[model samples]
Target: MKDVNFIFIREKIASSYLYFISFLGLITITISLLEIKIPSHSTILILLLIFMGIAEYFPVRFWRGTSSLTFPIIYAMSWQFGIHITIIAIVLVTLIIHLHRRSPIQRMLFNSTQHALSLILAEWFSNKCMHLLINNIDMSVLYENLISLLLFCVFFCFFNNRFYDLLMILLPQPYSIYQWYKKTVTVFLCETFGFSYAALMHVLISKYSVEVNEITVLFFFFPLVAISVISSFSVRIRMEKERLYELFLITTEISRGLTGGNLKHIKQALKGFFGIQAYGIWTKDDGNWNLLLKDGKVHFDISDHSEKFEGISKNLVFNDWKTGTAPGDEIFDSVIRSLVYFPLIVNDELVGMFVAGKSRTAGFFPEDVQSLATFSNQLANVVKTRILISEQEKRMILEERNRIAREIHDGIAQTLAGVIYQLESAQKKYRDKPIDMQQIVEKSIKDLRGSLGEVRYSIYALKPYPTQQLGLKQAIASKIKSLKQEYELDITYHERGHARALSFSKERAIFDTLQESLQNIVKHAQADKTDVLLSYQSEHVLLRVKDNGVGFSLFESMVKTKNEPHYGILHMNEQAEQLGATLQIDSSVGKGTEITLLIPDSQTRGA
Candidate 1:
């Protein structure tokens, strides 16, 4: 439920302007009574009053909205009847109109009083001008009547419009009065035609008073004038409707471009539809305007200046930048006279701005302001959507990298290290005899060949997630850069692999195990230099991380993990189980730590 009592003329001037107009109305009525005589043709006054009352009942649609037949009838009545009778008739007719309108008591009083004042002013102006333009002549003479008639008609038109303007100055509204003045010019032109009809009718009646009485003339002609006004109004409404609907279709196309994230299409649409000299999209970040896009002949560098927006208003259509009171007066060059600004709001937040400049001969109308604002809102929604998509893309890329690295570490790297340990032990046992060494060599060769084939297949299965079916080297390179930054260790990497493919899970396992081993060296080993090697043999794929630093015994490290339950060793063992690979740890009390993972050449080994 809206409270009607909350109505405001503005933040200020409600009481003051009301009293001021009332005072002026009183003075106008007093003057009309003191210096005025009643019209001899009182019937003419009655008929005109009745006509105005009927006109008010059925207001005609004219221009963007509506206009009344009351103005022309009132002007003619003021010219024919004397000020005393005419002023009284105006008050009676206004009361009838406002009472029927159900307008508030304060508004009805102010409006009716204002109309009375302008009418009295018009009457006085006509009488003074008539006396000055022509010498005193008999009221009966035709030429004298014509001279008086012409002077009164001119004054009637001038004072009627001017006094209406004067009444506006006493009130206040949210938007600037100058903006309203610009918006209402078209309506003013239509009203001019009505006033022209009033003047012509006044002249005719004054000229032909002898042949047909004023009442008889009025009875015949009033209906014809009413019909003409209504007919003109109907035509104007039809044209306006067609124009507005066409604008809607064009704006819909522009909005479509915005949704598709086509900046070029949006720019072209704005220029083609609006016919603007320049258009710009500006965003405010930390109170500075950033020019995101500019279209058309953007001659001035106003957007580059921080001072341009200072002391500027939030009004939609404006030309006030020329005023020296504004902060950046230099931005408004000679050619730029008018600008329309629309605030780009998204989700109820004023995030940015949209502004356009008009051609030299053209200016921004209220209709243009309304239409452009709609386009700006659609653009805001699109811009916000694009920002979200960009952020989401970055997040997804990071997650994919992590998944690939984890798979390689747990499978291929673990299996190769265990095969290397078995071959090293066989070397120690077969050292005493050449015949026994031949049999050991035969078994080791067979083991290496089988391991190598499985490692190749695993790498091949991880294709499309890396460089040429291999990302272990690339993943390791990424970690090396980070480790060097985090610690002062000089690390060297070597690869000895003919194998070039591995399964995604094997790739992830190998990557993760290598990462954990290097991280342990950084945190626990007092290493000055570290060696990382990837060796592919006939039976297996192997990875090694050896550091030259003060190191603890392998037994003591395992004992700590068993009692305190650290995740590092537990995680490595879990990954080894998942990949069916082997992890090995070698260290001495004074020497550094060495970690190796080995994968064999059987597909089922890490399945």
Candidate 2:
């Protein structure tokens, strides 16, 4: 629940904060430029600035954020050449790096300003500490500088992290205190490692000649760069693992059912993990493309791009509008500069289409497209399953209508015909035999009462007592009794263990599976006897429906189940999956077909 007023307030605060940071940064840059002096060691200063730029360019990224190896270079310059040169170096490197990243002007200014201010204030504080130490203790100049450098590094790390964390906290998005603490700890560790390297650089510059120090500085950065690259590689590996985990979670959620919340999770994952700005999911129903989920500023109408969607196969289709050569630019909003389109196909039939895009024109990474494609494959199954379920339900409704019609003809219709005959006879007897007419009228009244009872019974049987009133056990018993009475088949119901309460979803799944199984047995089993068992065990609940019937070939039925609308077993299995339960079917020619549903108690329990 994010309210409009809260969003407005957060936006106002963010805007004000960005403006203030940018102004302060610009002022710091101006003052630093005013105090600038071409130092005597200009070559060394140039070399340090170049290294700073390189370090900032290739930052080590983590799941939470990113870190750069620029601290050592910044500290070395700040100690050797003073604040003005260090400030100018930091500002220039920050600008170049941010510009390369296509960052907004406000963000670039804020980043440069924050880094510049942190370093300046930390340097000032460390100088005060160094002066105090020098006055109180009889320490060498080398020791004085070393202590000051350490203090600067510590203060710098603190200020940098504090400013960033404060911004995150003030933003509209959620940022927990626990997450903040973890991020702070991580930043501290990285800074500690960086400053340790800076310490070595400081000692060398102070003790060695300029030529030897410059050479050492140049070669020293090789290992530093190597470390950064290795850390980046590790981060990438970790990120991939995290994505795989996300995929698993998404699959689990969508498998439950087609719901708004499930679809929202997919949309959020795309935006959060892959930086997609716009997306649309469309399912093709009855030869018409219908929008299922959409977000951002996507302008894709299936009607407008029917040919394009029709042409898509197993491969992903994408375009980068920035290239000015990609097709179908009109299908997207101006803000969406790059996009990917994947067809959701199952059983070689296109069931749905997925489209996602980013504002950046560079388009999606290959691996990202691959991951999204796999997700769409999962989504394809769900869409297909939903379609099948809908068809199955429609068929069931028709079958029920036909059954009711037959019931009317067999019971109520015939009973009403008898009542009409008795009424006609009573009308005739009213004039001829008044005594016999009274008896005929009584028989007609009795037949009408039976008809009303039959209608009431049918209505009661349709109620969802499995989840609402009678509970699953009683519902099963009622269903078994109804089947026995209607088909005149020998039916047995047994219950074991103490029945515990189950979630509505689990109960519904079990009941629906049972209904499908019973319907199949009555229609096709050609058996004289049927048995149903409900067992509540310590770990799980089990339901078994067995019929002593002339069973069909299990192998052939499975083959048809895969390709055709064999909803009896297919629907049962789908319900089992939705409940996170297992459905096992066993049968052979001349042997009884047994259908068993096992639901783990952990899944059956209410949330």
Instruction: Say which candidate scores most in lDDT.
Output: 2
RMSD of each: 19.4, 13.2
Among these predictions, the greatest TM-score belongs to 2
lDDT of 1: 0.63
lDDT of each: 0.63, 0.77
Candidate 1: tens digits of C-alpha lDDT, residues 186-290: 446546666566555656666676444566658655874576557656755775575567566655665554443666665555554444666677665545676
Model 1, C-alpha of 122: deviation from truth (Å): 1.7
Candidate 2, position 563, lDDT: 56
TM-score, cand. 1 vs. native: 0.42
Clashes of each: 42, 0
lDDT of 2 by residue, 1-607 (tens): 2454675587579668877776776787788899887788777787888888877777776434678877888887887798877988898888988788776566677889988778777878888887788889997766776788789988888878777777776665456788777777777778888988977865776687334456766797768877877787787788789878877877777787677777777666556546566777778877877778777765646345544566677665444353233333355565455678788999899998887777543447567788888888998999999889988999999999999889989999998988898797678668787788878888788889879988997897777566577877777778878888898978888888877788877787778778888888899899988888888887788889899999888778777788544266777787788768899998988898998999878534532
What TM-score would each prediction reach against the true structure? 0.42, 0.54
Model 2's TM-score against the true structure: 0.54
